[model samples]
Target: MSDIRPGGPVFAPEEVETPPKEVSKSSKPASLWTDAWRDLRRRPIFIASCCIIAVLVVMAIWPSLFSSIDPFNARTCELATARQLPSAGHPFGRDNLGCDLYARTIYGAANSLVIGISTSVFAAIIGGLLGLIAGFFGGATDTVASRITEIFFAIPSILGALLIGSTFRGSGLGIWLVVISLTLLGWPMTFRIMRAAVITAKSQDFVIAARALGAGSARIMFRHLLPNALAPVIVVATINLGGFIAAEAALSYLGVGVQPPEISWGLMIADAQRRFLEAPLPLIFPAVFLSVTVLAFIMLGDAVRDALDPKLR
Candidate 1:
C-alpha cells in the first residue's frame, strides 16, 4: 500500500466495475392465424371469393336489411315497368310476375345457401363417422359397411335422392332424404381413404409405442391415429361441399328437391328455360351464382389441401 503509484491501480484499477449490456428478446414470430391471413390477403381470387361469399351470407341472413320490397308480394306491379331491363331502380330487372328480380334473386340465394350448407354438413357428419368406424374396426364390420357403401354408390346420387325424397312426402323430409341419400353414397370415398390411412398409421412407431404403453384399442385409434389421418378427410369434405350444392340444385331442377315457394337456383334455371328468349336474366343470374359458388369452394379446398400437406409445404 505504501508503494502504490497514482497512475497504477492496486488490482488493475478495480476492473472498472461495469454492468453487463442488456439484450432485447427477439420478437416472437407471428401466429398461425396471422400468417394465414397474410397469405390470404395476397391471393386476389381468394379475396374476391371471400367477398362474394360474405355478400351472399349477409343477404341470406338479413333479407330485409337491403330492401323493403316484400319478396312474396307479387301483386305490387308498375304496369309501365313490366319486363324492363336493368335500370336504376330494378338492378336485375323484373320477372314473369312483374316482381323485382333482384329481390327474388337475393332471397333465392339465401334459400339455396341454407339448403346446400345444411345438406353438406349433415352428409359429411354421417359419412365421416361411418368411414372412421369402418376403417378403424376391420373384419365383418368393415365388410358389411363397405358392401352397403358400394350398393349406394352404384346407384346414382340424384336418382337415389329423388326416390327417397318422393318416399318422404314433405319439404323438411325431402331435405333430410337428400342428405341421407348423399351421405349413404358419399361414405365410400371417405371409407376407402380412412381405411388406407388407418392401415398406414397402425404401423407407425407412435402407434406401436402407444400399444406398448398399454393404451386401449379405442384410445390408440381415436386419440393417436385419427387426428393424424384427418388432413385428407378435411380436404375431401371441403371439396364435397360444392358437390352437395350442385346435387341439391340438380334435384331441385328435377322437381324432387326444394318445393314450390322455396326458390332454388336449379328451379330458377328450370323456370327460366321456358322463357330463355323473353327474359334471360333469371337463368343467367342463378347460373352465375351457382358457378361462382362452386368455383370458390373448389379453390378454397385446393388452398387448404396445399396448406395442410407437409410435402407441399
Candidate 2:
C-alpha cells in the first residue's frame, strides 16, 4: 500500500497494525525472592543440597531414628568384639572404648549441626543489623562499623576461636562456648556483605521514593532495605555454616571443643587417632560424616549464590 502523495500530507503509512506486543508470562513483574525461588527450583544442585540438608536436619533432630543401638552401651571388650572391623551388626565397627563407632558418628551430627545453625543465625542477625545501620546512614556510622569489621577481620577467624575456646575450655559450657567463639568472629564477613548490598540497594529508585514519601528511617530500613540486603548475607551465612561446623570439629579435635560424654565427630577423630592403624573405622566413619555435612552446606551456599545473582543468569 502506497501513501497518498509524497508532496501532500501523505496518509500515515497505512497505520501498520503492529500487533500489540505480546506480553510474555515471564514479563510480569516479580519480587527478587520470587525470581530467586523460581530460579532455585530449576537448579539440580539446589535441589540436591536441599534434600541432603533436610536429611541432615532430621538426623540432627533425632539420632534414634537412624539407629536402635544405644550410644551409651559400653563395649564388651572381648577380643572378638574389641575393635572389630565392619560387620553386619556393627557397620562402623567398635572403637577402642567399645562404643559402637556408627552410633557415635550419628550422634556427633547433632552437635555440629546445632552449632552451625545457631552460630549462623547469631552472626547473621548481629552482622546484618549493623550493616543495615551503617550502609543506610553512611558517614560516621559507616566509618565506625567498617572500622570494627576491619578489626575483627584482621584477627583470623580460627585463631580467635582457638584463643576464646582455650580461655573457656574448662568452664563445661563446651558447645555453647565454641558457638560463642565462632559468632564473635563470624559476624564481620556477613556484615561486610550486607553493608555492600544495602549500600547498593539504598540508592535505588524505591528507596528514594520511600524517602520522598517521608517514611521513617526505621520503616525504610526494615521494610524496604532489609529484604534486598538480606540475600547476600544469607548466602554468606550458608557458606559460613560449613566453616563453623568444620571449626567446631577442628576445635574438638584439638581437645578444646565438646568435652567427654558429649560425642562429636572431632572427638571421635581424636579418640581414633591413637589407634588409627589398629582400628580405622572410628576415625573413618566420623571423618566421612563431617566431610559430607560440610560439603552439603557449601554446595547449598554455592547453589543459592548462583541462583540469587542476576549475573549468573
lDDT score for candidate 2 against the true structure: 0.87
Question: What lDDT tens digits, residue by residue, belong to model 2 across residues 246-271?
Answer: 99889888878888889888888888
Query: Best by lDDT, which number?
Result: 2
Quickly count the clashes in candidate 1.
Answer: 0
Per-residue lDDT, model 2, residue 168, is 77
- Which candidate has the top score in TM-score? 2
- Write down the lDDT of every candidate, Cα atoms only: 0.73, 0.87
Candidate 1, residue 80: Cα displacement in angstroms equals 8.0
Residue 29 of model 2, lDDT score: 77
Residue 244, model 1, lDDT? 81
Model 1 over residues 1-313: C-alpha lDDT tens digits? 4347887655544467699988768866775445645665676766776787788789889988877776677565464665678888878887666767777777777667776677556655666667777776778888998888788779987777778777775647645666666666665676666667776777899988998999998898789888877767777777777788788788878877767676767777777777789889867887888888888777776777665664664
